[model samples]
Target: MLRRIVTFVIAVLILGALAWALWPRPLAVETVAIGKRDITVTVEEEGKARIREVYTVSSPIAGQTLRIDRHAGDAVAKGEAVVSIRPVAPGLLDARLRRAAEAAAASARAGVDLAAADVKQAEAQLTYLRTELSRAERLASQGTISESALDKARLAVDTGAANLDSTKASLSVRERELERAEAALIETAVSDSTCCTDLKSPVSGRILRVLAESEQVVQAGTPLLTIGNPADIEVAADILSHDVTEIRPGSAAVIGNWGGPPLAARVRRIEPSAITKTSALGIEEQRVPVILELASPPPQGLGDGFRVVVSITVWQGHDVLAVPVAALFRQGDAWSVYRNVNGVAKRQDVTLGRRNNDDAEVLSGLTEGDSVVLHPSDDIQDGTSIASTSGAQ
Candidate 1:
């Protein structure tokens, strides 16, 4: 009876093992068929939306910042006043200049008066000298006047001419002084009145930053504000130097997350210098900065310094054999895919060319109708069986 029982147990165990080994199994899987499609190779980088023109309003002369007309994000017009500053004191240099001008004017008036008096005295002397000379000439012609008397008359005429010349010189000096004083007064008055000047905007744009406030004292060359236009913008993105080889001017780009829908962009320029940047992964990366010009008008609410996500298209091809990136596995330096054939997984070595984030270009070893496993596991080996729920096992 014991022998029979043991034999029965052994038989049952063997049958159960055989049944488990031959049982049909199901696989949790996602798969896609290979096909000819478009493929694009791209490099993605984070950037910021910045205006094409940024004008920094700086103090033209040293003074106190009296008032600010606009704040950050305020709209400004060309030739509009943005800030007004007043000097600590009416320009001392200008004040001294005014006083000097007043003194010069007073002196000029005094000289004019003196010149007029001299002119009067010269006219009186000339008249007396002419009368005396005439009398002496008449007397000499009558032979009653001496030769000495005639000589004296000639001397008097010459002296009168010298006196007139001296007076004319004095008058000329006075006139020049008056002209100089008038010019000086005008200049001084203008300077004193302009001790407070209203600063104006140099361009039409929105205010980006305001660095001054009312009643604040500012030094020479201090920056007061910044303004820029958002409608015209440029996106500067840094690309890894390794990936920059395929990127050139005129490449296409897509910008996102900049307070608007994705905007189309085009590469306008490539920086000549490369910069070293540390990535978030703690790796030192050599990056080249590329400048992109927006191809369309920016949407509303977009402003300067807005962060954006950029995808630069380095290369693209149409009607190319493409495969999902998950379907590929790296074997040493080459690529391979696990294709489903007759309910069995067949490992086929493949040659891949350009690859993007989601797909890769299949250069060889893939047919248009072949279905490949996405993310095949190690449990799936050559000739391993698979059961597709909708189709076959």
Candidate 2:
């Protein structure tokens, strides 16, 4: 009877050990507690800095532009000469052309001489008119001549003076023609002459580019260089057309990842039109250009065409109830999270508001200090035993 009782005790002990070994254990997971903090919703995109206004310097007239002495990035003052050009000499004329030019010059000289003679004649006529007017006044006062006769004399003098003035104008025109004829006859000789037309800078700024650096003949309106103020820099970000609706003028922004600390900026304008471009992934996209003005001077090394990352603040709230986005997942039609209650996982339905890349604003269901499982696994179910890696049971 004693041996049978000892066997029953050993069998009961083995059964209890088996049951303990097979019992379900708590699954380890990462969790975060609901907290109150400032949540900012931002649209992140890459962009570039550019001058607010780029002025292109162009040749004002056709001439031989001299070699440019200044290079790109050189500072220039307003009204300072940036380029120098000399008028090209006229092409060589043949014998017949030379004779024609000489004749034209002679004719012009004769016209000038005639003009001088006409001026003298006009002066003499004016003087005679003055004398005649004086005589007429005296006659009218003494009643020695009819009033109409005196008036007729005055009119004759005025007509003579007008004729003389007309002749003088014709002579001046002829003199200009003579000069043109003489210039045509003279052959232009190319030489290193100091006389040149200097092109001045329109604004005080740095040279952005040197379009023409070598000596060459340029026509009027040919672009020579570009200039812009480095301090007046702005950012241009290309955003998808769909995302443009959320942005507005005067929106706050942060410019970063440009080799220095982030800079504060604001949206100045949104282009009214959309442009089509092929993305690097070989996809066609419609993008709209948004202009951003920096709130302060850009950090050193930031200049025109410098690449940067921009985060535009679309929405923000202070001291709002929020949670890590990883904790939230779709449960049926509403958003839900695996809330840790004591040592078990409980499925809690949550209403979400504005969300950024990392955090989401919690509207209902979850309260401050509540722990929720981050990236809950498929195997985790309501009422499942769980433990948080962050010490939350």
Candidate 3:
């Protein structure tokens, strides 16, 4: 009887050990509790800092500009002489340029002669048409010609007069062209210092850039240097057109990644126009310019065309329930999350509002203080046992 009892006890102990070994355990997961906080949705884009009013100095006449003595960041007062240009002397002018000028003058003179000939021809035609009209009127009164013939003659005279006026206008235009061409032949005095024309800054600012650093012959309107007030700066960002709709003029903005503390700014305007640009992936994107004025003075060393990142707030809320974006996953057609419920993983479908790079706003199906899995894996299912979590097995 004692041997039989021992065998039964040992068999029961073995059965219990096997059962314990085979029983399923909980899956370990990272979990986070839903929290309420202030949330803001923003659109970020690369931007540049630029001066509001930049003045470009250019050669007023075709001449040789002296080597630029000024460098970037050189301060210049308004009316200060920035550079000088020596007007090209008539004898020193390029042979081709002189020849071109002579050719242009000759062409203008020929055009004037042609226009005068046209005017004289029109006058002669008018005289002939008037004579014809008088004869037709007499013949019509004498019943030798129909009134239609007289009317035709009258129309011819009217048309001839109009042609004469048009020819006169053309002649006037040709005359003006000849005058302009002759004026171009007038020699500028090159015997004295007066020949060197000093160009002055039109605004009070520092030289922002020196476009032409060395002495060179430049045509009229060739840029020499750029001037602007460095302190008066603004930021320009090109945002996707579809995303710009949420950005309004006067919207609050933050300027970052500019090698200094983030600067506060306000959107001065959103350009009405949008430019089409190709993204790095070769996707066509419609980008619009957004100008933001610095709410405070920009930090030192920030200047024109310096790169920065801008974040424009489009939406904001107070005391909003939010969750980590990684916690949510696609379940059927809606978003779902594994909510930790009393040591069990419960599948809960959630409604999401605005989302950014890190977090998502929960609109429904979840409340504050609820625990949810951070990165729920495939092994986790509804009612699955979970461990290493606050509300887990």
Candidate 4:
């Protein structure tokens, strides 16, 4: 009888201990106090710094770049000569080509001069013909010449008149030839000027690139140097296509790593075209280029093509009521949070709005000064008992 009573009591104690072990208990959580603060949605991007206006200096004529005054990073002002070009020893057909070009040019000039002379000669002939015709008519009228003789005089007058007309026509043709010759002369002179021609900067800026080395032969239109104003700098950053819809002109930005401190900026323009850029994940992303104008000019040391870090502000709110994003929970399209009231957890459905960085805008259901659970778990249910510690409320 004694053993049976002892076994029964022991079995009851074990059953009670097992039940206690399996029972639910209060969950520990992190909490955040709701308040108002400024939040901004930023898109981080890496871009290369570039001058506002870059002018590529090219050879105006085919020649050798014989002189260069300044190299890259050299400061230059307007009308400053940066490079000089001199004609190289003429090409394979240099002599013959030169002679032909010179001949063509001379012929054109002569043609022009001849046209002017012909015009003068034609005017004189016309005047003389008019005088002779008048004399012939007067003689016929006075009967000093017979009818056939008068007729002969009239024919001579007609021949003179025809000659005058032919001279005038020749003058017109020669005038056109003169224009052609002048063009030919210019072309030949440009190709064979042994004297050096200076290439000057059109604007006050710094040299960004040097395409020509000393004593290098170059053809017309070959770029020699690039110069631009470094004071007026702009950042061109590419943003993902999906994120582009949220960006617009006049958006705020923070520019950094242009060899100096962070600078404020604003979006000036957004390129309408989209380009494909391969991401590290091997996904092809459609990106749109955006131009951000720096609010403050960089220091003098900054040069063109320098790398920069840009953060474009896509959305912003100031002095608005917000809550920590960790405190919010999403269910379908709705968001909710666990509000700690008198050491008990209560579920409050919240209407959430624009969020940025670490904070989110609370539209309703939660008021300022309310404490909400941060990163609440599924086990924290409605009307649940809770304990408040320094770390967890």
TM-scores, in order shown? 0.68, 0.71, 0.72, 0.70
Better of 3 and 4 by TM-score: 3
Cand. 3 TM to true fold? 0.72
- List of clashing residue pairs for candidate 4: none
Give candidate 3's whole-model lDDT: 0.91
- Every candidate's lDDT: 0.83, 0.90, 0.91, 0.81
Question: Model 1, 1-393: lDDT tens per residue?
Answer: 999999999999999999999986755555678788898888898987788888888988777776675678788899988788776553434677778888988888888888889988998899999999999999999999899989999999999989988998888888887887766666322343565777888889889888776668778799988888867788888888988888989999999877667889899999988999999999999999999988977778766778898899988989998888988888778798888886778889998889898888888889787888888888787788876432221
Among all windows of 10 consecutive residues in model 4, the one with the lowest summed lDDT is 184-193
lDDT score, candidate 4: 0.81
Report the C-alpha lDDT of model 4 over 251-344, residue by residue, as the tens digit: 8898887777788988999999999999999999899998888787777766667888889888778888898888888866788888899878
How far does residue 315 in candidate 2 sit from its true spot (Å)? 1.3
Top TM-score hit? 3
Which has the higher lDDT value, candidate number 2 or candidate number 3?
3
Question: In model 2, where do residues sit more than 4 Å from their true spots?
Answer: 1-21, 90-190, 391-393
Off by over 4 Å in 3: 1-22, 91-194, 390-393
The candidate with the higher lDDT, 1 or 4, is 1
lDDT of 2 by residue, 96-146 (tens): 988888898898888888888988888888889879988998999999999
